[model samples]
Target: MRATLIDDLPDEKLATAVADLVRPGGRWRKVDRGYTQAQQWIVRWPDGRSVFVKSGTDALTWGWLEAEIGVYAAVDAPWMPRLVASAGDGQGCGPVLVLEDLHEAQWPDPWEDTMVAAVVATLEEVHARTAPAGLPPLSDRRDVLHGWPLVARDPRPFLSTGLAGARWLERALPVLEAASARADLSGDALLHLDLRSDNICRHRGQVKLVDWTWACRGNPVFDTCAWLPSLHAEGGPRPERIAPGQPEFAAMLAGYFCSQAGLPPQQPGSQRRAVQRAQAAAALPWAARELGLPDPGDAPREGVPR
Candidate 1:
């Protein structure tokens, strides 16, 4: 679980380990975006072939990286990144996951309506595919839903910023909890818990989903519903248009993000808290709109919160 960067390893050893998977003489260039838990790089082979590499030495990230390898190995969908190679023990040096480099792929910009529809369709296709049973269950997120009850007892994190009045937030907690409890988070289909724009790409006229660390067996609709807050915050259509008639599911997700947003920062240079806060802010209004409650106003634009 020690923090180990690619530079910490001998060049020859690293090359030898990856040689079987990619062209032997490829160069590694760090990819500086959307990688929080691991070191990521795009490896370009001298032959013009390329692959994306994600390596993690910390226990949390290594575990997720390993899970990603399993998910990739288990599924064969066009919308997913093809797995190239992987290395690691369950523990120790951790794991390195290499995947197909999506050539000429571009991240969605301004999130036009057509692009949003494409993303939703792609997600639906992924959910339609049967998921292998051994994957982690959605029940693992139970703590996230149950955490709302505790917020009333300790309101410091939720009140520290004064973004929403403490009194209003307190009054909404019970309603949020009730709606969250009614949500059906269980399902047989695979769910991509993280579906932000950073993890999605468009290439060859198709949408592709990436970052399988949070992949799980859950209500597929939850995946689509959860994406609304981020989509709206990023200039896409409102939540009602993206996912309509799912107020309970939206409420559950709002609680999840709001609870996480309240926590203190977990690491140096980490934007997890800020991102969660933005999502929470964005989600509140959607939930309120669905529940016929007063609007909480616009959330900060999507990205790392300033």
Candidate 2:
């Protein structure tokens, strides 16, 4: 009863794989309630040290997690947790990771401006470092959100309901297409593409980032947008959605600019516009597919959004 894939693979297969990865004197325990996959677990060693583990076999997920370790290691910031150990190749059944467990740390709820600022500033600092000129580029918005077959073809069935939702989705399409046109997969930055609150922790008065599945080199603005949904989800004392054009976003940008020094700030208006555009671009294609609307085919703007 350790952990098993949602693909309905036999529990024995998963247990065997977990057993193979569990080191001597280490135990893997199931941690129910996962966002991405069903087999998430906390691996505990006899010495009382523990690392979190998540598994998947689609693309470069295991490799991406490893790449995240590389990103944090390369950064000079104090915000990232130390890497422990990871398992898995590119494919098959048992690929997983065992990393430092920052249990005492908790995520910033509703992502207050202060929390957003701290993360933005930290990312800015991370982005400032120089790297080898050509690292294979990280996946963009489409790649991150829609790589799965269900997501790639259509997500509206899973994301929305009713005609009103459909209209909102429709209104958002052209903007999505336009923004995607500007997406450059070749752009590089110190990116934690999945910068949601769950993957971040506040430990001993320091902020630490975890969950590097979507980490990569790319445009920093794209990084901001990628983090936006979760940040918006975390905004406010009660933890509600952050409305577009709020002062909180301004503060977040202020913190990022403060850390970045020479970086030009994205105007709040422009950022909101970009958000709306990105939302549409990010959602519409799949929505159309979900609704049985014919795919418009890949235009110049139909590629992944950076």
Per-candidate Cα lDDT values, in order, are 0.74, 0.47
Candidate 1 worst ten-residue window by lDDT: 1-10
Candidate that scores best on lDDT: 1
TM-scores, all candidates, are: 0.88, 0.56
Candidate 1 lands at a TM-score of: 0.88
List model 2 lDDT by residue over 123-165, tens digit each.
7776665443434455434433322233224534323321123
Q: Candidate 1: how large is its RMSD?
A: 5.2
Q: Candidate 1 local accuracy as lDDT?
A: 0.74
Lowest-lDDT window of 10 residues in candidate 2? Answer: 254-263
Pairs that collide in candidate 2 are 88-95, 110-234, 110-235, 111-234, 176-281, 189-218
